[model samples]
Target: MGGRVLGYGTYHVLTHLTSTELYSHCELVRNKLVPLK
Candidate 1:
């Protein structure tokens, strides 16, 4: 997929990062993540 699509997917994934248990996974992408801006 393209960068834009990948970014969207990452944003979607971030949305599910509310459960502290998943913070680690969120951190992995948080730095390189680009929201739907």
Candidate 2:
């Protein structure tokens, strides 16, 4: 996948950050992530 797709996926996940369904996975995934923008 390209950055475009990656960006979209990130946006989708961020938008759903409060979702109970993905909370655990999101936390694990975002634990070490830092935004440059």
Candidate 3:
């Protein structure tokens, strides 16, 4: 996916950070994860 897609996914994940998976996602973003899809 393109950066725009990754960005949107990140935003969606962050908005739902209450979920366990989303919490992990937040960590991934916080740690500067790349190649997210």
Candidate 4:
């Protein structure tokens, strides 16, 4: 039970981190590709 809970939490954390990283990467690319105001 504990192991399952830990695994679930870890999976969610990794997913969140990956999503955050992806968003940041997209933002960076957009900033570089798009002109500033």
Tell me each candidate's RMSD, in Å, in order: 14.8, 13.3, 14.4, 2.0
Q: Using TM-score as the measure, name the better of candidate 2 and candidate 4.
A: 4
lDDT over C-alpha atoms for residue 28 of model 1 = 68
List per-prediction Cα lDDT, in the order shown.
0.75, 0.78, 0.80, 0.97
Report the alpha-carbon TM-score of model 4 versus the true structure: 0.90
Pick out the ten consecutive residues of candidate 1 with the lowest summed lDDT.
Answer: 28-37
Model 2: ten consecutive residues of lowest lDDT = 28-37
**Ranking 1 against 4 by lDDT, winner:** 4
Better of 1 and 4 by TM-score: 4
Q: Residues 1-37, candidate 4, lDDT per residue (tens digit)?
A: 9999999999999999999999999999999888864
TM-scores of all predicted structures: 0.41, 0.43, 0.43, 0.90
Ranking by TM-score: 4, 2, 3, 1
Question: lDDT tens digits, residues 1-37, model 1?
Answer: 6999999999887777655547776876786676733
Top-lDDT candidate index: 4
Give candidate 4 regions above 4 Å deviation. Answer: none
In candidate 2, stretches whose alpha carbon ends up further than 4 angstroms from where it belongs are 18-37
